[model samples]
Target: MRNFVVSFVIIFLGFTLAIVYHNNNKNNMVKAFAITLSLLKPTDDKSVILINSTIISDFFKKYPDLKKYKSDVSALYKNRNYKSIWYDRKGVIEFASLLYSKANLLNEEGIESNLAYKDKIDGIFGKKSTDKLSPTDTELQLSSLYIFYSKKVFQGIDTKKIRETGWFLPRKNLSYKNLLDSLLINPQLLSKNEKQLFGQYYKLREALKKYRLIEKNGDWNPITTDLLPKEYKLGDSSKTIGQIRQRLAVIGDLKQNSKSNLYDKELMAGVLNYKKRNSMKMDYSINSMLIQRMNTPIEKHIKAIIVNMERCRWIAPEMTKADEYIIINVPSFKLIFKRNSKKELDSDVFVGETMNETVIISSNVTQIVFSPYWNVPNSIIENELIPAISREKNYLEAHNMEWKNGKIRQKPGKKNALGLVKFIFPNADGIYLHDTPSKSLFQSEYRAYSHGCINMSKAKELALLLLKDNPDWPIERIDNAMKGEKETVCILKKKIPIHIVYFTAWANDSGEISFYNDVYERDSRLAELLISDDSK
Candidate 1:
């Protein structure tokens, strides 16, 4: 009887265990079926639906217009495990709304690219409720919108296009996926601390708006004057003087118009300010050339501002992060050495002329050669030297030049074309910054006269500043090296980055706007690329 009871208990317990296992498996199958149904069919709570590659594929297939952004869209979704990035249980997220607004008003950012499917996005927002929302469609549209915004604001023109425009400066590498991740975490990134674009771009954008406003108000009247006087100085009186006062006041150079025909002390101050800003000789006397520049149409200034904004876009924000760097603005004919984000040295420079325009690039200054030899470029030897030698036998001797190793090089002296010292940032173009024999050229307002290299007016000062910390090269030694006939090369302890840029329009930290002459006529070429109607 005891054996029978034990067997009966064991069989009943085994049967109960099998029933519970079967029921658990059945419940799991039912739950899986419900999940598959939710994915296949739209659910009441959109967040419950699983976002997968198939849904994204179907979304793209339905909206073939956004096929151009396939790679960007794919990468964005793949990074998030095919989850809906722009949408949530409530509706489209805050960033979507902000991005849409920014895209619609791209002009405010000085961008010309048209946003794709902008009207469709508007219609989606126009709808009062999320009842008609298609999750897949919404996701794709937002993805496309993000790409459009990135291209215009962050990427600027394509790399190939910028190179074609003659901009060889190091292009900024932008990671839109990372930017999106940050935006997802904090939508306020769009408005604050957008470090992707260079800081100068924002400053130029603000100036652009102000200039556009001036244009909208029928622009200031052009200053018309007779060829009455050779020079207009302080205390001069004429009808033209009154027009100058009005022009200066309109452009914020003068405190008030005063409506007086006399060129008094206040007007003199305004004229000096204007001259300082416009790269003109900082004197009280006004000349016809200065007046002509002042009379440039507001439309042309607006165009210049737009062109420079494009340039600012190409510059990487990271370039400015360096503790020390050198910047040479070609159009401005100015070189600035910055340390710890402040101007350590600023000097007037001579750049290449229109035919031999200086290349826009960035490199590291590794060495400074004092009493440097001027290695005459083959092009120069063929074009100028050979012809000059033919005309005059003593040409080489007079210029202190000699032929060596099948190439012509000027001996290191006061008459050497490369001047007393040269800063070498080895590049393919054979360009460097050096001192010039003709110091008088620095006094001129227009100083674009070089053979693809930069000539610094204060070369000695720059050398001293660069070697200030080095015990091996003191100021006395630097002066002796520059004055000595023997060429001396000194390698820098730390390589300083040098950036050569061409900008016709720029705004200072104080919001003062300055316009420069397009010495190489590159503004129009760049403007054509930026403003052209072709869609990328």
Candidate 2:
């Protein structure tokens, strides 16, 4: 009886302990589950709402058409700790609506394509219907739309295609995740954030609108010269002059069209203005070429503006933020030097000929060589030099060239092909900026005369300005160095950024647009890629 009582008591104690342990374990599990659920839910701060990542994965699976943006969407959500950015306690956020509107009007941004899942996206904001998506579906759809819109408007086309277009300048790398965060805080940035885009983009967009309006309002008739003189100048009278006057007036080159046939002083002023805008010599003469330029249809002009705007999309606004830089527009045959955001110099430049096209690139002007020797490229040697030598044995001696290390190099002198000075910016293509002995070429309206390197008309002036801040070099020394007696090299203490760009259309600060001839026939090719839905 004693042994039985002891065994029963021990069993009872063991059973009580087991029950306590089980209850404690269940309570701990319940507490842990409650904490995890809290983490997955919206916190006291409305902006800190969390979301289940599984929903995002499911969303992409259902909408495979929008899967292109799935990675970007996932990164955006993960950046906010799996938060729902496109939504709040309300069904949809105001910025989401703004983004949807932007996506709808991609045409205004020079984009011609329908967004992915357009019908589903439209249904999100449309009137109530059976096709209305769930709250989660609506949120994911809006996020995908925002990515599409940003890629089209801010980023232009893909990098691979842009590189294929022959634009090698550094492209903009924007973080849309952070961009969205800022937009959510201050939605005004959605419209006023010019910093996010190249400044020229906005200018070109305004020009596009103006040209489209002109096309819509019955474009001006083409000027005909069938029975008129080949050229029209001041005091020249013809029916063609009346047509020219009307043409100039249509594009704001002339304040008003006089409706008179005689070419009067007003018409001469208009002609000069027209010539200036078209990158022609600012003179009172109008010829077949000027008339041909004027004959370009409004549709072509709109396409050119759109093409340039697309090019602008590839550039970043921060590129121009440097303290000093040089912008060489190959089509315009002009070089713009800016320091502290002010135009320091505007000089004439001649780029490469058609067969040897100048490459669009960016680099730093590292050194300036005075009285530099011309190391003729191997292609030129093989093509021209060997043949010239075969024709005349005295060709090399007469040109002050000699075989150095089995390669031909012209001695530094007045007769040197690369005139008195050369600005060296290291590049793989072996191209640089230098003065040319052929000063007469700069006088020509079309200055595509170089082999590949740029020939600056004001090379000496540029050297002086670039070295002005350096105490080691001054105006007197620079002039002495250009006398062509021997080679003198000056490595710049501070390198200046130089960008050789190809822009056939540009808008001035006054919003007046100027058009240049497509020197390399790049506009049409780029335009085709820009407009093609497949390229996008």
Candidate 3:
């Protein structure tokens, strides 16, 4: 009887162990079938979905611990919206909790999306409720990473160096306040693509520094250009001025002249045009002025070019209105006005001479006075008058000039220095647009005939437009202003901004560069500095 009872217990235990083994094997088979189904994609779809009973069996086998939690990830598969990551919405919440373990790193906006909070298990990781308006940190970092990399790649900022400098050296730590103040409300300066806001990453300190020597001295000399050592490359080309002249000599545009003092008109004009294009004067001579540009350190010029490139990037590509605005190429001594982005007016302008060079400026026009009085500057008296007075006491009266209270003034009339008209705009520099009696001087290719003011070739058209807004203005009225009369002031209803600048060398719209004479003698000074290393 004892043997029979032991056998019965053993048989029952054996049957139970077999059943457990069978069940375990069946569950594993279901999981394997679910995973295998992924390899056999539907003919019409990019991925395969398992709709058999194996999916549920596999779901339990793979995520056996889900029952202990409040949710199951099988729902993602059911919804057919599983992302690339194996983690579903619930898993994302759990993972995020581990990331923001730091307390107070974020505010109320952060808590709703906190993955660590058990209350958000059923809630989707990135699903927005009425309270949340933005993505979670995970999404934000991922999306912004692309933008950050793209910006770094496009701008070519040395990211490795930037990162090594604590990530703030070149971006956040800028002299933004001073630059903002200096710009004085030109919002575009700051509106540029946020990359250069950290006080231009490059430096043009030497180039500007070398060029400014002329600003103080009014001309380039050995002290500024020739004495310094510099090497510059325009754009991507590596040819130097000497190398370029050699190449051009083959074409006869330049003669193979090597003396520092000697330069032909073709070489001279080319250098001048470069200056003009670069916002220097078109002196139309390759003297000291040409040397300045040629000698500026390449690094400094690169910085300046980068800065201007950023500036141009900020400007709107399209015109705002269908109106007229004129751009005077000071170095080239040319003016162009666009109407609806089309060239409506074009003319030549006589810029300031080197001794009394025109200041670079921009302002709106207030009026145009035709046949206006010439208020002789004291410099004229000191330079031209005192010398003339020393020669002939009657010279002042012959020139219609008078002195009162130590001030010299010229009255309007035929042979008056101001000629038929003077276009007026009040500025600190006392510069204006006007016509000159020396119209014959315009025939010369080099036209610098002003004392820090602009002389327009088509001053008559400017007069007509100044009076266009004035309903009462007529030709007779203009003629009266032109007739050897006293000073007349014609106020403009709509003022225009006039920019007097200097640029000597510029590539034309047709891609061919137009060079000018270096009237200011700045090129030679700059070039000397550039070749200072080479010459030495």
Candidate number achieving the greatest TM-score relative to the actual structure? 2
Candidate 3 at 407: error in angstroms? Answer: 1.6
* lDDT (Cα, tens digit) per residue for candidate 3, span 140-209: 2221222222222123233343232111112222232233233333433322323432222112222334
Candidate 3 or 1, higher TM-score: 1
Top candidate (lDDT): 2
Writing each residue's lDDT as its tens digit, candidate 1 over 98-204 gives 88877778888776667555566776678444344466676677788898777777777888989887889988887878988887788777754448778888788
Every candidate's lDDT: 0.82, 0.84, 0.47
Error of 3 at 270 (Å): 17
In model 2, what lDDT does residue 152 have? 76
Clash counts per candidate, in order, are: 0, 0, 53
TM-scores for all candidates: the values are 0.89, 0.90, 0.44
Model 1 residue runs over 4 Å out of place are: 1-50, 127-133, 192-194, 533-536
Cand. 3 TM to true fold: 0.44
Error of 1 at 125 (Å): 0.8
Evaluated against the true structure, the overall lDDT of model 1 is: 0.82
Error of 1 at 76 (Å): 0.6
Error of 1 at 93 (Å): 1.4
Q: TM-score for model 1?
A: 0.89
RMSD of 1: 7.8
